[model samples]
Target chain A: MTATVSYVPAPDAAPRSRMLGAQTRMELRLLLRNGEQVGLTLVVPLLLEVFLNLPLLSSLGGSRRIDFVVPSVLALAVMSSAFTGLAIGTGFERKYGVLKRLGATALPRSVLLLGKTLAVLLLEVLQVGLVCTLGLALGWHPHGNPIWTALLIVLGTLAFGGLGLLIAGTLRAEVTLAAANLIWLVLLFAGGIAIALDSYPAPFADVARYLPSAALSDGLHHVLQNGGGLPLGAALTLLVWSAVALPAATRWFSWE
Target chain B: MPPQATHAILAPSRPDEAASGPALEISGLIKSYAGRRVVDGLTLTLARGEIVALLGPNGAGKTTTIEISEGFRRPDAGTVRVLGLDPLRDAAALKPQIGVMLQDGVGAYTGAKARELLDLFAAYAAHPHDTAELLELVGLSDVAGTQVKRLSGGQRQRLSLALALVGRPALVFLDEPTAGMDPQARRGTWGLISQLRADGVSVVLTTHLLDEAEQLADTIVVINHGRVVATGSPAELVRAGAEGQIRFRAPAGLRLTSLSDALHAGASASEEAPGRYLITGERSPQLLASVAAWCAAQGVFAEDLAVERRTLEDVFLEMTGAELSA
Candidate 1:
């Protein structure tokens, strides 16, 4: 028997804002409440600042350690919230079939990813603000344009979050979880610190400038420490990373 | 009054049939995992408000098949239409009208309260059920404030069910929804399912428990080795059994020669155990009575005398050549 078909398009359907906004808000709440997320985004940066301020490191830096540490730490905060958070969370969600459940919903996949990105951006803004407040309390002041700094943060998060999803979506959950967290730690220490990338020497320092953490840190520092305008070169590098990583991540993401 | 009744009375029913087409239809569904076909050449149709149970053994392709239907995975080869839209082609459009509950939903949200998670999901649709009403519907109001991590297994499953229903979906897919529930919890879920059906919501579920399928399914489709072996009403399938089983004990020294000759006329017997024998293929009442009369005449006493209707378990084992996991 032939099945009859008819089409009725809903032209007056409400805009997709409600669902997108709610998904982002819920993601933010879940991230904040998670202990590891809290530690990674909040406590880790604050502790890193304190550790960088040690007197033994004072000889290695002419500038106040807090001045140098704050910007790099902000980048760290963004990475944690964007890259590590997305990777670990998405990996677990995939492992536990959360994404598969969502896949079956009527919510668009693009909207889902967009909501998550927005949530991560919201988290980075809050983290940057909080860390900046603490830096001001410590008498550390940024000399660069705030607008340029904000742009870097947003673009940097997109790039990192895209890479995070790419890793989490393609690899086994355990492997993704382990590799993401480990990369976070390695980048934290080995990549350019409050110390200059050039000061480290040889292959390590040369490769450091290419690392995303290093790119973001270098960009933020040029703007924040030197009172400079947005660094177009660094922005372009991160943009290229974002352009490639975003598509790769979305293409590879698995619901299960 | 029950929660479902309140909603049913308040809501106006949609037209019985959509002007568009079948609520869901799939043809030539096929999927494989690591080169092994899990769901091969499966076709299914579900109308609005129909609850169909996809019954099968472990790894029998039920989950794979449903995942494809739900648009979680792309089919290797198939045409799937959900609510007149292809799930793969129009996933975004179809998702709002359907809900999915997977078998495992552990450790996703860390400290989010149950109600918070529900509200979060509910927000994903233009029309969302009231958070309180949804919680109440799933019997989760008392634990609204509880973090998901702290919820018991049954409570978590209930929360998952609530998540699936919160969108007020026209179609829902539940994978082994009652795996860890106690009897009370299982019945509660069944009650919820019945309520969903009454409200004109269609559900497709995969489960190994025959009783669940028998209780909740309007139609049951059984799959074995990635192929649909049988599909029918529980009663019709049971009625097709070739024969019934009869059990009796022979009198000491009565000897198998006489019993075999007596039952060979219309039945067959085998020593299923040392002292007990099972006579199968006994179609005539006279043969059953003759066996009983022979036992009596031989002064043999038989215990555990009981006859049972054929069950889904019997049909499943017979057709699939495999046992359903408890």
Candidate 2:
């Protein structure tokens, strides 16, 4: 047996980030490997986008369905990854005592939350790319400034992700499950998706158009369908909503 | 099998400021759920390198106390110091110095491997134990690749222990660590705990099993109805509760009163059954010899003669006024 020569450094010199980075890497790897998260965040959204924009829906409404479905489905993708995925995932985590175990360690809570958020963001980005690719391939020309479109996507991600955290953190797993699914349904149907708020009677449309989910859909649709510039007001409104909801939700997220 | 060797590994590699102080000092700990007080006015201190078993029946404030000590719950009005740092106020600084294995209540159990969980926890500590070494120590080396949810109950318990030790904490808190395990599994856990002690890690464990406390604890604190009923070494608590009781079936024709009178001369005796009697005294030799002589003088033999020493169960029964099992 041969002993390998080892270099020994002076004691008390290693930076904490070296250790934290290693742990974060492992956490990221585990997260990417989860089948359900991948299915819900990536596969489901891609299928829904492609399926809704097929010749059947386009022929019925002359591409208006495709125009409406693109932005609304993006909303669905965000909801699935940020809210439903996190809520169900965190719920199961509480059930198994994973949060409690993590809390017991010296790892900063900020790092833990950040790691989870980053993983969700990575999936969200992938979702955006897939949806964009399908929209481009299906002869839907997005005639807006690429920079403005990028800004809208970022704002929408922040808003929905914040709302999702609020739901996952504050509500019980069962309640979060029901509420997230319910919210998704409401946004899909009544949130100015297939039917425009302007097409509605009067006051309801005026109010519904300002909702974060509705604003995101309207902003994205304006850019993709009408070659319109980014609606700075609606984007800011969504940003403000996220700023408020994200902090509150993150503050109250329960490990158990 | 002893406690000091592994503790040497668990002990901080760098100098610690609170080395001379108590391992844990908890004072006036109070926690309330809704309007009910769960833990109230509890104060206790654990010394360095000692194993203290907290024994209590269900809903006896053990969870609340342990949680507060671990910096998980804020006390309504109390102070808790782990390694001399206030657990709640200085949790970040104190956390690295302690290892806490809560009852596997938080979810981190996707299909990720056990080694992955260990690595994650090891990241939380300043100087985590080697991941492979920790897995082997916890008896999960063979199944390192198995997902956490796929592990059996005993295997999960072992994984939980490994996660807790990843930081090589100076003090380890184990809550009902061996609740459901076969004899072999239980013994394996005991061996690991023994190994931890040999390494110098102070362990505070809560268990309903008296035998576990008897076998593992250097000191036992029994709590009932949200208060500490008795605190001492296991043998002391038991010996203080009941100095060995002796029971025997005397001759059928013998008068119960006469037998009691004769046995009472040597020790306290009472007829517990039709022809059976129980005797208790401070000294075993004097008590047994007198019983034997009386039986011989009566030309009768005693049947089912049994002498029992004080046990942790007896102490728990005496303090709580409820059977340990019940």
Residue-level lDDT of model 2, residues A1-256, one tens digit each, is 0111111111111245754575456655655688877777778777877777765643324255566666767766776776677666766666556677667777677777666676666766778788878877765565677677667767777777778777767777788778877886787667765456666678888888878777877887777666788787779888898898888877887866
lDDT by residue (B1-326, candidate 2, tens digit) is 12233333433443474567888888887888997888877878888778898898888899889998998888898788888888878877777777777764214655678887777666665445668876776578999998887888788887878776766677899998876666787888887786767656789999888889989998888988777888888778876746768889874456656656766454677777678877787656767887888888888788999988867787787789886662
Q: lDDT tens string, model 1, B1-326?
A: 23343343322223333433666788888888899998889888877677889899999999888877777678888788877777777766667777778776532464679988887777775556667876776678899999988998888888888788776677788999987888888998898787777767778999999999999988889988888889887777777764677775543344666777777465676676676777776466776776787678777887665444567788899999999989
Question: Candidate 1 - CAPRI tier?
Answer: acceptable
Which pairs of residues clash in candidate 1, taking residues 3 or more apart in a chain or in different chains?
A: A105-B95, A106-B95, A106-B96
- Chain A TM-score for candidate 2 is 0.80
Model 1 residue B199 lDDT score: 62
Best by DockQ: 2
Could you say which candidate leads in TM-score? 2
In angstroms, the error of model 1 at A214 is 3.1
TM-score of 1: 0.86
The 10 consecutive residues of candidate 1 chain B with the worst lDDT sum are: B8-17
Off by over 4 Å in 2: A1-36, A55-72, A193-199, A226-229, B1-17, B104-107, B252-266
